[model samples]
Target: MDGPGHGDAALSAPTLTAREAGLVGCRQCTRVCEAADERCPRCGARLSSRDPGALQRVWAWWLAGALLFIPANTYPMLITSTVGRASEATIVGGVIELLHYGSYGVAGIVFFASVMIPVGKFVAIAYLAILVQRGHRTKPKHLLHLFEFVEWIGRWSMIDVFVVAILVALVQFDLIATINPGIAAVCFALSVVFTMLSALSFDSRAIWDRIKTLSND
Candidate 1:
Protein backbone atom coordinates (compact mmCIF):
# COMPACT_ATOMS: atom_id res chain seq x y z
CA MET A 1 0.00 0.00 0.00
CA ASP A 2 1.11 3.59 -0.69
CA GLY A 3 2.10 5.78 2.31
CA PRO A 4 0.09 8.82 3.47
CA GLY A 5 2.04 11.33 1.33
CA HIS A 6 2.52 9.04 -1.67
CA GLY A 7 -0.93 9.54 -3.20
CA ASP A 8 -1.41 13.21 -2.20
CA ALA A 9 -1.16 14.40 -5.78
CA ALA A 10 -3.81 11.93 -6.89
CA LEU A 11 -6.09 12.90 -3.97
CA SER A 12 -6.00 16.64 -4.68
CA ALA A 13 -7.76 17.89 -7.78
CA PRO A 14 -5.97 20.27 -10.16
CA THR A 15 -6.96 23.88 -9.72
CA LEU A 16 -8.25 25.61 -12.81
CA THR A 17 -6.94 29.10 -13.51
CA ALA A 18 -8.89 31.86 -15.26
CA ARG A 19 -6.64 31.59 -18.30
CA GLU A 20 -7.11 27.88 -18.38
CA ALA A 21 -10.87 28.43 -18.26
CA GLY A 22 -10.72 30.78 -21.25
CA LEU A 23 -11.25 33.88 -19.11
CA VAL A 24 -9.40 37.15 -18.81
CA GLY A 25 -9.48 39.56 -15.89
CA CYS A 26 -9.76 43.29 -16.26
CA ARG A 27 -6.91 44.92 -14.38
CA GLN A 28 -8.81 48.09 -13.48
CA CYS A 29 -12.23 46.72 -12.48
CA THR A 30 -11.16 43.11 -11.78
CA ARG A 31 -14.06 41.79 -13.84
CA VAL A 32 -13.49 38.41 -15.45
CA CYS A 33 -14.35 38.04 -19.10
CA GLU A 34 -13.91 35.76 -22.06
CA ALA A 35 -10.32 35.21 -23.21
CA ALA A 36 -11.22 36.89 -26.50
CA ASP A 37 -11.92 40.16 -24.70
CA GLU A 38 -9.77 43.02 -25.84
CA ARG A 39 -11.34 45.56 -23.50
CA CYS A 40 -13.59 45.51 -20.46
CA PRO A 41 -17.10 46.56 -21.42
CA ARG A 42 -17.98 47.75 -17.96
CA CYS A 43 -14.98 50.00 -17.37
CA GLY A 44 -13.45 50.37 -20.83
CA ALA A 45 -10.17 49.06 -19.48
CA ARG A 46 -7.74 47.14 -21.62
CA LEU A 47 -7.77 43.43 -20.84
CA SER A 48 -4.65 41.36 -20.39
CA SER A 49 -3.87 38.10 -18.72
CA ARG A 50 -0.72 39.66 -17.28
CA ASP A 51 1.07 42.95 -17.37
CA PRO A 52 4.30 42.86 -19.29
CA GLY A 53 5.88 45.72 -17.37
CA ALA A 54 4.39 45.40 -13.92
CA LEU A 55 7.66 44.50 -12.23
CA GLN A 56 9.46 47.30 -14.02
CA ARG A 57 6.99 49.81 -12.71
CA VAL A 58 7.18 48.32 -9.25
CA TRP A 59 10.99 48.60 -9.16
CA ALA A 60 10.84 52.13 -10.56
CA TRP A 61 8.54 53.41 -7.83
CA TRP A 62 10.36 51.42 -5.18
CA LEU A 63 13.66 53.02 -6.15
CA ALA A 64 12.10 56.46 -6.10
CA GLY A 65 10.69 55.87 -2.62
CA ALA A 66 14.00 54.56 -1.33
CA LEU A 67 15.89 57.53 -2.68
CA LEU A 68 13.49 60.01 -1.12
CA PHE A 69 13.48 58.15 2.19
CA ILE A 70 17.20 58.90 2.66
CA PRO A 71 16.71 62.68 2.70
CA ALA A 72 13.53 62.30 4.73
CA ASN A 73 15.46 60.75 7.57
CA THR A 74 18.54 62.99 7.31
CA TYR A 75 16.82 66.37 7.05
CA PRO A 76 14.86 67.92 9.89
CA MET A 77 11.14 67.20 9.86
CA LEU A 78 10.11 70.15 12.01
CA ILE A 79 11.50 73.52 12.93
CA THR A 80 10.47 75.07 16.24
CA SER A 81 10.93 78.68 17.25
CA THR A 82 10.39 80.14 20.73
CA VAL A 83 11.27 83.75 21.48
CA GLY A 84 14.89 84.00 20.34
CA ARG A 85 15.58 80.29 20.32
CA ALA A 86 15.06 77.90 17.42
CA SER A 87 15.52 74.18 17.05
CA GLU A 88 15.02 71.52 14.35
CA ALA A 89 14.22 67.85 14.72
CA THR A 90 14.43 65.00 12.32
CA ILE A 91 11.99 62.09 12.61
CA VAL A 92 14.26 59.93 14.72
CA GLY A 93 15.47 62.94 16.70
CA GLY A 94 11.89 63.91 17.45
CA VAL A 95 11.08 60.38 18.59
CA ILE A 96 14.12 60.43 20.84
CA GLU A 97 13.06 63.78 22.24
CA LEU A 98 9.62 62.38 23.01
CA LEU A 99 11.27 59.46 24.76
CA HIS A 100 13.47 61.83 26.73
CA TYR A 101 10.35 63.67 27.90
CA GLY A 102 8.94 60.34 29.26
CA SER A 103 6.23 60.25 26.62
CA TYR A 104 6.81 56.56 26.10
CA GLY A 105 3.46 55.85 24.52
CA VAL A 106 3.70 58.67 22.00
CA ALA A 107 7.32 57.81 21.26
CA GLY A 108 6.51 54.18 20.71
CA ILE A 109 3.58 55.01 18.47
CA VAL A 110 5.58 57.47 16.41
CA PHE A 111 8.58 55.16 16.15
CA PHE A 112 6.46 52.23 15.07
CA ALA A 113 4.37 54.19 12.58
CA SER A 114 7.13 56.33 11.12
CA VAL A 115 10.27 54.22 11.38
CA MET A 116 9.48 50.53 11.70
CA ILE A 117 6.53 50.48 9.34
CA PRO A 118 8.31 52.31 6.53
CA VAL A 119 11.42 50.14 6.81
CA GLY A 120 9.27 47.02 6.91
CA LYS A 121 7.46 48.17 3.79
CA PHE A 122 10.73 48.74 1.96
CA VAL A 123 11.93 45.24 2.79
CA ALA A 124 8.58 43.63 2.03
CA ILE A 125 8.22 45.32 -1.35
CA ALA A 126 11.73 44.40 -2.45
CA TYR A 127 11.32 40.82 -1.25
CA LEU A 128 8.09 40.39 -3.16
CA ALA A 129 9.57 41.91 -6.28
CA ILE A 130 12.61 39.65 -6.16
CA LEU A 131 10.52 36.55 -5.45
CA VAL A 132 8.19 37.13 -8.38
CA GLN A 133 11.04 38.11 -10.68
CA ARG A 134 12.99 34.96 -9.88
CA GLY A 135 9.96 32.66 -9.84
CA HIS A 136 11.08 31.23 -6.50
CA ARG A 137 9.33 28.21 -5.04
CA THR A 138 7.64 30.11 -2.20
CA LYS A 139 3.88 29.66 -1.93
CA PRO A 140 1.88 32.12 -3.96
CA LYS A 141 -0.72 32.53 -1.21
CA HIS A 142 1.94 33.72 1.20
CA LEU A 143 3.19 36.26 -1.32
CA LEU A 144 -0.36 37.49 -1.84
CA HIS A 145 -0.79 37.97 1.89
CA LEU A 146 2.44 39.99 2.02
CA PHE A 147 1.29 42.12 -0.89
CA GLU A 148 -2.06 42.78 0.80
CA PHE A 149 -0.31 43.72 4.02
CA VAL A 150 1.94 46.16 2.18
CA GLU A 151 -1.12 47.75 0.58
CA TRP A 152 -3.00 48.04 3.87
CA ILE A 153 -0.13 49.69 5.73
CA GLY A 154 0.77 52.13 2.95
CA ARG A 155 -1.43 54.96 4.23
CA TRP A 156 -0.53 54.66 7.90
CA SER A 157 3.14 55.52 7.26
CA MET A 158 2.07 59.13 6.84
CA ILE A 159 1.16 59.53 10.52
CA ASP A 160 4.41 61.34 11.26
CA VAL A 161 3.85 63.74 8.40
CA PHE A 162 0.32 64.41 9.56
CA VAL A 163 1.56 65.15 13.06
CA VAL A 164 4.06 67.65 11.70
CA ALA A 165 1.38 69.34 9.64
CA ILE A 166 -0.91 69.64 12.65
CA LEU A 167 1.85 71.08 14.80
CA VAL A 168 2.74 73.56 12.08
CA ALA A 169 -0.87 74.69 11.92
CA LEU A 170 -1.75 74.93 15.62
CA VAL A 171 1.48 76.20 17.24
CA GLN A 172 1.82 79.78 16.24
CA PHE A 173 2.46 82.72 18.56
CA ASP A 174 4.33 85.09 16.20
CA LEU A 175 7.45 85.12 18.37
CA ILE A 176 6.66 83.34 21.61
CA ALA A 177 6.29 79.92 19.94
CA THR A 178 5.96 78.69 16.39
CA ILE A 179 6.29 75.36 14.63
CA ASN A 180 6.84 74.88 10.91
CA PRO A 181 7.24 71.82 8.77
CA GLY A 182 10.73 71.34 7.45
CA ILE A 183 12.03 69.82 4.21
CA ALA A 184 11.96 66.36 5.73
CA ALA A 185 8.19 66.51 6.14
CA VAL A 186 7.68 67.04 2.42
CA CYS A 187 10.29 64.42 1.54
CA PHE A 188 8.77 61.91 3.93
CA ALA A 189 5.29 62.49 2.55
CA LEU A 190 6.52 62.03 -1.00
CA SER A 191 8.42 58.90 0.02
CA VAL A 192 5.28 57.41 1.53
CA VAL A 193 3.29 58.27 -1.56
CA PHE A 194 5.91 56.74 -3.83
CA THR A 195 6.06 53.54 -1.81
CA MET A 196 2.28 53.31 -1.91
CA LEU A 197 2.45 53.62 -5.67
CA SER A 198 5.17 50.95 -5.77
CA ALA A 199 2.96 48.52 -3.88
CA LEU A 200 -0.03 49.32 -6.06
CA SER A 201 1.89 48.90 -9.31
CA PHE A 202 2.96 45.38 -8.35
CA ASP A 203 0.79 42.68 -9.89
CA SER A 204 -0.09 40.14 -7.23
CA ARG A 205 -1.44 37.82 -9.90
CA ALA A 206 2.15 37.40 -11.03
CA ILE A 207 2.76 35.43 -7.88
CA TRP A 208 0.36 32.74 -9.00
CA ASP A 209 1.65 32.86 -12.53
CA ARG A 210 5.26 32.38 -11.46
CA ILE A 211 4.33 29.45 -9.24
CA LYS A 212 2.26 27.89 -11.99
CA THR A 213 5.13 28.14 -14.42
CA LEU A 214 7.46 26.56 -11.88
CA SER A 215 5.01 23.74 -11.29
CA ASN A 216 4.67 23.06 -15.01
CA ASP A 217 8.47 23.00 -15.47
Candidate 2:
Protein backbone atom coordinates (compact mmCIF):
# COMPACT_ATOMS: atom_id res chain seq x y z
CA MET A 1 0.00 0.00 0.00
CA ASP A 2 2.94 2.34 0.50
CA GLY A 3 4.38 1.72 -2.93
CA PRO A 4 6.03 4.57 -4.86
CA GLY A 5 2.78 5.34 -6.66
CA HIS A 6 0.67 5.68 -3.54
CA GLY A 7 1.92 9.18 -2.59
CA ASP A 8 -0.56 12.08 -2.22
CA ALA A 9 -1.33 14.19 -5.26
CA ALA A 10 0.73 17.19 -4.01
CA LEU A 11 3.62 15.15 -2.60
CA SER A 12 5.72 12.83 -4.71
CA ALA A 13 8.13 10.16 -3.56
CA PRO A 14 11.41 9.20 -5.15
CA THR A 15 11.46 6.64 -7.92
CA LEU A 16 13.64 3.58 -7.49
CA THR A 17 15.54 2.50 -10.56
CA ALA A 18 17.01 -0.97 -11.11
CA ARG A 19 20.52 0.39 -11.55
CA GLU A 20 20.26 2.47 -8.37
CA ALA A 21 18.96 -0.48 -6.39
CA GLY A 22 22.06 -2.40 -7.38
CA LEU A 23 24.56 0.43 -7.13
CA VAL A 24 26.97 0.50 -4.21
CA GLY A 25 27.03 3.21 -1.57
CA CYS A 26 29.98 5.35 -0.61
CA ARG A 27 31.59 4.24 2.64
CA GLN A 28 32.42 7.74 3.85
CA CYS A 29 29.09 9.47 3.91
CA THR A 30 25.53 8.22 3.74
CA ARG A 31 24.60 11.18 1.58
CA VAL A 32 25.05 9.60 -1.85
CA CYS A 33 22.91 7.30 -3.97
CA GLU A 34 23.08 5.89 -7.48
CA ALA A 35 22.95 8.37 -10.33
CA ALA A 36 19.65 6.96 -11.50
CA ASP A 37 17.95 7.61 -8.20
CA GLU A 38 16.03 10.86 -7.65
CA ARG A 39 16.31 10.88 -3.88
CA CYS A 40 18.96 9.61 -1.53
CA PRO A 41 17.66 7.12 0.98
CA ARG A 42 20.00 8.37 3.68
CA CYS A 43 20.84 11.99 2.94
CA GLY A 44 18.39 14.32 1.28
CA ALA A 45 20.99 15.86 -0.96
CA ARG A 46 20.97 15.21 -4.69
CA LEU A 47 22.73 11.94 -5.37
CA SER A 48 26.29 12.88 -6.26
CA SER A 49 28.94 11.17 -4.15
CA ARG A 50 30.33 7.92 -2.89
CA ASP A 51 31.03 6.59 0.63
CA PRO A 52 33.95 4.33 1.36
CA GLY A 53 35.88 2.99 4.34
CA ALA A 54 38.32 5.86 4.36
CA LEU A 55 38.71 6.39 8.08
CA GLN A 56 39.28 2.87 9.40
CA ARG A 57 43.05 2.40 9.19
CA VAL A 58 43.91 5.94 10.22
CA TRP A 59 41.71 5.69 13.28
CA ALA A 60 43.21 2.33 14.11
CA TRP A 61 46.71 3.73 14.30
CA TRP A 62 45.47 6.81 16.09
CA LEU A 63 44.05 4.67 18.87
CA ALA A 64 47.28 2.77 19.29
CA GLY A 65 49.30 5.95 19.47
CA ALA A 66 46.89 7.38 21.97
CA LEU A 67 47.42 4.41 24.21
CA LEU A 68 51.16 4.87 24.07
CA PHE A 69 50.84 8.52 25.08
CA ILE A 70 49.86 7.74 28.66
CA PRO A 71 53.15 6.16 29.57
CA ALA A 72 55.21 8.57 27.53
CA ASN A 73 54.19 11.55 29.65
CA THR A 74 54.30 9.68 32.91
CA TYR A 75 58.00 8.90 32.51
CA PRO A 76 60.90 11.32 32.88
CA MET A 77 61.97 12.85 29.58
CA LEU A 78 65.13 14.86 30.27
CA ILE A 79 67.89 15.38 32.85
CA THR A 80 70.16 18.38 33.25
CA SER A 81 72.88 19.37 35.71
CA THR A 82 75.94 21.50 36.11
CA VAL A 83 78.97 19.15 36.20
CA GLY A 84 79.55 19.37 39.94
CA ARG A 85 76.08 20.64 40.82
CA ALA A 86 74.27 19.07 43.71
CA SER A 87 70.85 19.01 41.99
CA GLU A 88 69.79 17.48 38.70
CA ALA A 89 67.15 19.07 36.55
CA THR A 90 64.40 17.21 34.70
CA ILE A 91 62.21 18.43 31.84
CA VAL A 92 60.02 20.43 34.17
CA GLY A 93 63.10 21.72 35.94
CA GLY A 94 64.58 22.87 32.66
CA VAL A 95 61.46 24.84 31.95
CA ILE A 96 61.62 26.31 35.39
CA GLU A 97 65.24 27.26 34.85
CA LEU A 98 64.35 29.08 31.65
CA LEU A 99 61.50 30.83 33.36
CA HIS A 100 63.70 31.84 36.27
CA TYR A 101 66.18 33.33 33.81
CA GLY A 102 63.37 35.46 32.31
CA SER A 103 63.30 33.42 29.09
CA TYR A 104 59.53 33.27 29.02
CA GLY A 105 59.26 32.77 25.26
CA VAL A 106 61.85 30.01 25.21
CA ALA A 107 60.24 28.32 28.18
CA GLY A 108 56.82 28.53 26.61
CA ILE A 109 57.97 27.13 23.29
CA VAL A 110 59.94 24.32 24.91
CA PHE A 111 57.14 23.31 27.21
CA PHE A 112 54.55 23.53 24.44
CA ALA A 113 56.47 21.35 22.05
CA SER A 114 57.66 18.90 24.68
CA VAL A 115 54.61 18.71 26.87
CA MET A 116 51.58 20.23 25.18
CA ILE A 117 51.90 19.25 21.52
CA PRO A 118 52.42 15.52 21.90
CA VAL A 119 49.68 15.13 24.47
CA GLY A 120 47.29 17.25 22.45
CA LYS A 121 47.93 15.25 19.33
CA PHE A 122 47.28 11.98 21.10
CA VAL A 123 43.98 13.14 22.54
CA ALA A 124 42.83 14.60 19.26
CA ILE A 125 43.82 11.52 17.30
CA ALA A 126 42.02 9.31 19.78
CA TYR A 127 38.89 11.38 19.51
CA LEU A 128 38.91 11.24 15.75
CA ALA A 129 39.55 7.53 15.77
CA ILE A 130 36.68 6.93 18.12
CA LEU A 131 34.37 9.08 16.06
CA VAL A 132 35.24 7.23 12.89
CA GLN A 133 35.01 3.85 14.54
CA ARG A 134 31.56 4.65 15.80
CA GLY A 135 30.46 5.43 12.24
CA HIS A 136 29.19 8.80 13.33
CA ARG A 137 27.31 10.15 10.36
CA THR A 138 26.57 13.62 11.65
CA LYS A 139 30.14 14.82 11.40
CA PRO A 140 31.08 17.65 9.12
CA LYS A 141 33.65 17.30 6.36
CA HIS A 142 35.71 19.92 8.17
CA LEU A 143 36.38 17.45 10.96
CA LEU A 144 38.24 15.18 8.59
CA HIS A 145 40.08 18.15 7.19
CA LEU A 146 40.89 19.19 10.74
CA PHE A 147 42.34 15.73 11.23
CA GLU A 148 44.59 16.28 8.26
CA PHE A 149 45.83 19.49 9.81
CA VAL A 150 46.43 17.82 13.15
CA GLU A 151 48.38 14.97 11.62
CA TRP A 152 50.46 17.35 9.60
CA ILE A 153 51.29 19.43 12.62
CA GLY A 154 51.94 16.45 14.90
CA ARG A 155 55.30 15.79 13.24
CA TRP A 156 56.62 19.01 14.65
CA SER A 157 56.20 17.48 18.08
CA MET A 158 59.62 15.96 17.56
CA ILE A 159 61.17 19.38 17.47
CA ASP A 160 61.40 19.67 21.24
CA VAL A 161 62.56 16.09 21.71
CA PHE A 162 65.19 16.48 19.05
CA VAL A 163 66.31 19.75 20.52
CA VAL A 164 66.70 18.14 23.90
CA ALA A 165 68.62 15.28 22.37
CA ILE A 166 70.92 17.67 20.65
CA LEU A 167 71.38 19.65 23.83
CA VAL A 168 72.27 16.50 25.78
CA ALA A 169 74.70 15.41 23.14
CA LEU A 170 76.36 18.78 22.73
CA VAL A 171 76.39 20.25 26.22
CA GLN A 172 78.74 17.91 28.01
CA PHE A 173 81.33 19.77 30.03
CA ASP A 174 83.18 18.00 32.88
CA LEU A 175 82.57 20.77 35.41
CA ILE A 176 80.42 23.13 33.36
CA ALA A 177 77.00 22.08 32.00
CA THR A 178 75.64 18.67 31.00
CA ILE A 179 72.35 17.46 29.57
CA ASN A 180 70.93 13.99 29.62
CA PRO A 181 67.73 12.42 28.30
CA GLY A 182 65.33 10.71 30.69
CA ILE A 183 63.17 7.63 30.34
CA ALA A 184 60.09 9.72 29.74
CA ALA A 185 61.88 11.60 27.00
CA VAL A 186 62.61 8.44 25.08
CA CYS A 187 59.10 7.13 25.55
CA PHE A 188 57.59 10.48 24.64
CA ALA A 189 59.71 10.65 21.52
CA LEU A 190 58.70 7.14 20.56
CA SER A 191 55.12 7.99 21.20
CA VAL A 192 55.36 10.99 18.90
CA VAL A 193 57.11 8.94 16.23
CA PHE A 194 54.51 6.20 16.41
CA THR A 195 51.66 8.66 16.47
CA MET A 196 53.05 10.35 13.42
CA LEU A 197 53.42 6.95 11.79
CA SER A 198 49.87 6.10 12.72
CA ALA A 199 48.62 9.32 11.19
CA LEU A 200 50.47 8.52 8.00
CA SER A 201 49.26 4.92 7.94
CA PHE A 202 45.66 6.02 8.00
CA ASP A 203 43.83 6.22 4.68
CA SER A 204 41.18 8.91 4.77
CA ARG A 205 39.74 7.89 1.42
CA ALA A 206 38.27 4.69 2.82
CA ILE A 207 35.42 6.42 4.60
CA TRP A 208 33.64 6.95 1.35
CA ASP A 209 34.06 3.31 0.47
CA ARG A 210 31.65 2.28 3.19
CA ILE A 211 28.83 4.49 2.01
CA LYS A 212 29.15 3.45 -1.62
CA THR A 213 29.30 -0.24 -0.87
CA LEU A 214 26.53 -0.46 1.71
CA SER A 215 23.99 1.83 0.05
CA ASN A 216 23.77 -0.15 -3.12
CA ASP A 217 23.89 -3.50 -1.38
RMSD of each: 5.2, 11.2
lDDT of each: 0.91, 0.65
lDDT value, residue 98 of candidate 1: 99
TM-score of each: 0.89, 0.62
Alpha-carbon error at 178 in model 2, in Å? 2.1
lDDT of 1 by residue, 20-63 (tens): 77899787887878888899988999888888999999999999
Q: Which stretches of candidate 1 lie over 4 Å from their true place?
A: 1-14, 27-30
Worst 10-residue stretch by lDDT in candidate 2? 45-54
Q: Please give me the total number of clashing residue pairs in predicted model 1.
A: 0
Model 2, 64-133: lDDT tens digits are 7666667666655666677566455555667788999999999998788767877777777666666555
